[model samples]
Target: MSTKALDAQPKFAQIKQYIIDNIRAGTWHENQRVPSENELAEQFNVSRMTARRALSELTDTGILTRSQGLGTFVASFKSQSSLLEIKNIADEVRLRNGHYSCTVLSLESMAAVAPIAIALGVEVDSQVYRSVLIHNENDTPLQVEERFVNPTLAGDYLQQDFADFTPHEYLSHVAPLTEARHTVEAIMPSNEVCQWLGLFNEEPCLQVIRRTWSAEGIVSFARLISPGSKYRLGGHLTFKKKQP
Candidate 1:
């Protein structure tokens, strides 16, 4: 597009694009305040109303947050997770504009036991990376993820800092997931499960056993447990006929 064509666009639209570009470039990060409308107006050589229009539009779209006494800051990201597919807890929390956090209870290289080896479709005593993770949304504990990973899928599993990234996120980047299966059910909490999720002995827990696959073979098997009283399983799907 020519400079004249660009200049001909609506001032608010241009300002919005400029702000978006800065955000995409990491010049502005989450919770970081952007320039005030007065500052933006002066910088863009536009009226305050035009500048506010850009900020207002972004705020409405869940990009920016506005406060009465304090200045506007970038809104936290939050979204719903996919129940039918492998979803990263961090990504799901952020999409819903909620804070996502994790505690890595354990990350170790261990020999897969009989059940774990069967789940991964590998020989008994095969090497695997195992981790225990507690995922939280907005500071409240939600789920405990006990996962056994095929080392071939995520060779660097023990090195990465899970506090900054989730195993699901890491696996997606390293090993492409071709498919996944999830089975959810409610069960009486075990001693370990009760402690990890802060559930009482009598309380039942919602458990989701997920098996993910890659082109090579089974990628990882995860047992996700959460307090039944606190969370209910959810899913999103579209109804359609099978293609011929």
Candidate 2:
């Protein structure tokens, strides 16, 4: 957005950006302590609630982790990415002994773009449902999910509360997957992704795009992004000696 747009932005949002800028600037490295709610309120001359909202939003997006006794600290990404063939991110967090939470940014219908159309086997410009979600582990932002659904396959998608359940969990319960294709790459996050993930523009993100099919046909297409500084793809395998 333009400078005027940012200037006109809300104070909490400005605080959010300020926190991200410091993180990116190495002023607040991983595991470092961030200003307390009272301190931030004083520094920004805003109410404690305003400061808390800024910090809460950042924590929800996985930039900071809060403890019951300890003050908030820059979250460290020490856990591995999903190892299951069909990775449910919530499950991943649980397996790592972390509390899981989600914030649903959007769930709406729009005309499909070309790539999304092909992924859903719908014609370009066909109506499709899309949702943007942020998943956090222990109040730290973990992943940003951008999902496009075939409306015919998931007609009630918009009616569901994703914050109570994940798009992956809901779809898997509604339409069991028959096939899936995944693509993974590391790249600089987009402007919006950077904002949502609480990362600087130069921060790298692990991008995982996937398309799924149910017995009835295409079910959904999704893009999942993880902060590269804190996430990695991981799996385990067993080896056998042949007639040793």
Candidate 3:
């Protein structure tokens, strides 16, 4: 860590970045315990509170995990998605050398409720397609996908065999998303969702509420949920410096 660089940011943020950089550089690895607050406070010449804040923030962001008696360790992100792009979950898992599979729990057309209608930009009680699926990585359920589709966008949604292709892949072929919006939050999933994802009691889930549009109209609205400890969202962006 550079002294000038350390001076350039808040003490806690600098320390946090130092830890992140180390993790990125492979100095610290998954399941490896990180330095304690006392050790980091001494190294950074900051209070234990500052060091603790750095660790807490990282842990909250899913970069680290903490145990009661054990120290903080790098979190093993078994499944990851890019915050910058829309991708197929099956492909995402396979890219990481994990086996991908899915079970279609429900696939049917139904009358849209108020929230589903609004999300799909359809009239209340209008016909829409809904599909519920559990996506797995290495036979462990990693995500629970609940999606409502605009019939105008993907009329054949309920007819396809999801075993042959994911809903994302099917929709992309028919509609080809021109725009998308996503909202992410940490949530305590519903009992059914927890059961599908095989999460323990009180375990937090990362939820992404997503809406996508084609050149025609809103294509689909989806809620994708995963156990926070097993999945993570990340992105990398590079900005070019402006000319003087």
TM match of model 1 to true structure: 0.64
Off by over 4 Å in 1: 1-81, 240-244
Q: What is the lDDT, from 0 to 100, of the residue 95 in candidate 1?
A: 51
**In model 2, which runs have C-alpha deviations exceeding 4 angstroms?**
1-77, 239-244
Candidate 1 vs candidate 2, lDDT winner: 2
lDDT of 3 by residue, 1-244 (tens): 6878778999999888888888878999989999999999999999999999999988755677889898999878656688899978887766444579999999999999999999999999999999999999889999999999999889888889997789999999999999999999999888999889887776889999999999999999999999988887887698999999
Quick one: ranking by TM-score, best first?
A: 3, 2, 1
lDDT of 1 by residue, 95-161 (tens): 5445889988999989989999999998899889999999988787788999999998788999999
Q: List the residue pairs that clash in candidate 1.
A: 77-94, 77-97, 78-94, 78-95, 78-96, 78-97, 79-95, 79-96
Candidate 3, run of 10 with poorest lDDT: 90-99
Predicted model with the maximum TM-score: 3
What's the lDDT for candidate 3?
Answer: 0.89
Clashing residue pairs in candidate 3 are none
Provide backbone clash counts, one per model. 8, 3, 0
Q: What is the TM-score of each candidate against the true structure?
A: 0.64, 0.66, 0.70
TM-score: the better of candidates 1 and 2: 2
lDDT of 2 by residue, 140-177 (tens): 88899999999888889999998788998889988999
Candidate 2 Cα lDDT to native:
0.85
